[model samples]
Target chain A: MKGASEWDRHAPSSAPNPRHTRYHPRWHRERIPIFWWVGHRRYTLFILRELTAVLVLYSGLLLLAQLVAIGRGPESYQAFQGWLAEPWVLALHTFVLLGLIFHTVTWLNLAPKALVLRVGKIRVPPRAVLVGHYLAWIAVSALVAGALVWVAG
Target chain B: MSPVAKGAGGRQGTEPERVTRSREPLLWSLFSAGGMASALVLPALAGVLWVAVPAGWVAAPEHGAMLAVAAHPLTRAAVSLLLILFFFHWAHRFRYTLYDGLQLYHLNLLIAVATYGIASALSALALWIVWTLG
Candidate 1:
């Protein structure tokens, strides 16, 4: 490989092999920010958007599977339950929980800006939107959890 | 809306003041509502579903029951509805991300329309498939 100075210069006018002489952006060794790689605005936002629905869809599938097992005889349900009892499933659940938390944070952060709820002169801050979403998420999650505990009890 | 328009599409001289229109808010409003509901509902439901599995309050479905549940008309309808609304919210949100993030002038409207159109069309296809043979 040529020195940085050599790479900086334009392709030679008499280079026999044009492709080799041509300077690639990589030749400059410019460090792209980690955020630039798929973490750029489009992909990051796309993934963030999809992650929520994906969680919902996967959860739906999981719940539907359990519901089906329940619909079957007790024996079948027990077997499916055993599978869920595995350590792997617990690990997966923990991972999903972390993902959900991330989703909630990003979603709430974007929520105010997304809604763009504004007054005449002073616009509502994005942080306010996020705080509102957090309060709602916490309340709803608590209510659902409470209801589940009650039913399960 | 300022009269000192300097961007590529901004008017040169004295265009009608009426021409200064804010972007449409109808779709944005609908999406905001739907997003809020989904953001609230899904996470809540997820918690319920998660707990029920461990507590044995809800029986686990065999693969067959899972398939059958998918086959059920109500379940199929719910899934399809979720898919459509999710896509609508996603496309709407992403369009703004593209506009604001990339600063692609003059293409924002086109991109937004295209994104939503594709999402809607795909969602329709998914609904049709699930409804027919979910």
Candidate 2:
């Protein structure tokens, strides 16, 4: 066998042989492109989370309008309903509802990461917060839906 | 600074001042969660409000309590405050939805401007209605 110095001088640390594996095939394949690697930027993520608030604002605005129309008179309120029932407005509302659902799911997922409230010395898990929010939303939604159905019945 | 250090020309880690409420993760999460909850609850409430008020099942309060508040100086100030905060909140949230949901990055700036502009206009309209009613 060659001495250490002699071996170091002649032998390559990275080998050319196929079995030697100077380059990893998996690593090369797994490497993400620069832009793709960014996935989504923080600013984008922040804005995405904020979509829920926008949805709330929009709903509030519409509700306020409905109230104002009712205040004006039944005819005006009926006219407002006619406008809302338009295909385009209904479509927009449907689209916004779907968006709100997505926003809710994402926001719930991030809640734990965003809030690390400790109950005494015990730290509350993020999942718990998410589940709580979802549960509350479901409960509130159900209550309103039930009331609507009851009234309609 | 090295290109590598600057996230390869991306924004630095520090959040912009206007958007920065604080770094408390719990508060941020709760706020976001609250926003989301409100998003869900408000729409459903709006539906109830829509049906009840029109069906004469429930009286619309905005015409009375809300309008009365609008008439008062203190309440008018409060209403304006709510409108502004709510508009900003809407803008802050819509900016994100547009950025992520729509793959139309080419139209990102337009979407941002439109979302915010519409929200501001709507808030203004709400204020206008309140003032007129009051």
Candidate 3:
């Protein structure tokens, strides 16, 4: 774009060079504002999806803390459980649950696009992919719940 | 003036150019695995731990049983993998969030380092906790 205007730029377009093909970027994206995602519904949902990364990150850390508490002994573990029982913790978990559920639903919807499955010759349909994700989610969730309940009993 | 191509060696006065192999694919794989794992099981786990058990909607598992399960080598390994994948997922998502949402591409390298650094550090912590448990 820089040198094209001053010279015979149409030379390449009109009579293409068989040997060399010079490349130039055609699309120029405009600068966006910092809070660009705040206004639109779709954009806002994207932001929420991205923010769930933080939720999961903290959740990982909390799991680590629980493990450490477990290693510390029963008394320390009880204290950790007691700490979680605090009203503020529950309130925080309320939002955490919402954000994580959003993450799950949205991520599952994207499974079809990400995973292009095929059995031998025929390509798997996107609907099947979506259904498979939901089914897997349900199965895994049930497995975790069942494991915990089994341990309790 | 005739069109001249730039040299592959970079500028005359600048430092020597370095060929970089991007680790994007590997990071994305981790992110994908993490996203899937978290999405599948996190809601139920979070509900059980942070809400149901804490809020008294459900009974908590016995201490001995929990300790026994956590002590198991299989459980420890599974948890370690989960934590590592989860952290990488966070790193990738948060990195892009800052890149696109706030348009902070100028600090691209720094943001990348910081986000992945946190992930790596926390992953080590998670591993240590799991290894030392039970």
Candidate 4:
């Protein structure tokens, strides 16, 4: 009994029952390949969408830094601007700009799916929903630009 | 073997399993909201700041003018919200990227906590800076 208890203690928990074992044909479940996104166009695009978050983070940090620079006075603000004027900074901005555009386009395309707008008994068409998003976007941008111009002038 | 025995054996061998529910829906909602907001505003913001100003396509606002905009109460509020949402947006995307891209679902709890914590901290810092700006 002592030896049996010791053996049980060292044995695997929930051992397979021999009585339950049967000759069942195993189904081959395909494992996800490492480059799964590369296999499909949509997958690649989805990955790119996921990637644009990095650019978003970058822009957020840049804006925060600019705010801090502004608070630090005119010399610091000018220094920040000078740093942004560097060629490498310009190149990085170009890539970030492209990423932001891709992010916006993909996001707009998905808006219709996520948003179900209805007026009374009528459901708004998907195309109309997309158009509304674009129009609103343009209006907001124009408002900001106008404000900036007004402040500057 | 009899039908009863065969059925018993099959039932013992393969029972339906319950899947664990994930607590990701809450984070996903913030991600969706942030994505929508950024989609609308970020492109234009990036266009003017990174493209037009840098390329000399538009006159860059003077430092004082830019400072005035930044110091405006409405501008500060909007920017703070935008930055916070953007950070959360990045946090959610990055968490999923790690989960699916690198197959880090085993560390889901840790990753979620860490990512959201960082985002919250950064958002607080950004808000403080924006609020305290003269």
Fnat, one value per model: 0.15, 0.30, 0.78, 0.58
Best candidate per TM-score, number? 3
Model 2, residue B56: distance off in Å is: 16
- Write the residue-wise lDDT of candidate 4 on A1-153 in tens digits: 378777665443322442333345777977887678886989888888898998888899999998899899999988887887788988889889889989988888888998999999999999999999889888878876666557656
How do all the candidates rank in terms of TM-score, highest first? 3, 4, 2, 1
lDDT of the candidates, in the order given: 0.59, 0.57, 0.83, 0.80
Model 3 docking grade: acceptable
DockQ of 3: 0.48
Please name the candidate that would achieve the greatest lDDT relative to the true structure.
3
Residues A1-153 of candidate 3 have per-residue lDDT tens digits of: 569665566454433442233566666998677888888999998898899999999889888888888788889889999999999998998889899999999999999998899999999999999998899999999998888767867
lDDT of 1 by residue, B16-99 (tens): 222323434666664565466557656656545554555455654344444565668876777667666656665666666655
Q: After superposition, how far is residue A106 of candidate 1 from its true place, in Å?
A: 0.8
- Per candidate, chain B TM-score? 0.63, 0.49, 0.83, 0.80
Ranking by lDDT: 3, 4, 1, 2
Ranking by DockQ: 3, 4, 2, 1
CAPRI classification of candidate 4: acceptable
Off by over 4 Å in 1: A1-53, A119-122, B1-38, B51-134
- lDDT tens digits, residue span B1-134, model 3: 11221332222122111111257888889999999999998999898888888998878776788899999999999999999999999999999899788877556666778999999999888888898877
Please say which candidate is ahead in TM-score: 3 or 4.
Answer: 3
- Quote the TM-score that chain A achieves in each candidate: 0.62, 0.61, 0.79, 0.77
Model 4: lDDT of residue B59? 79
Off by over 4 Å in 2: A1-57, A143-153, B1-37, B46-85, B94-134
Q: Write out the backbone clash pairs for model 1.
A: A65-B61, A66-B60, A66-B61, A68-B61, A69-B60, A69-B61
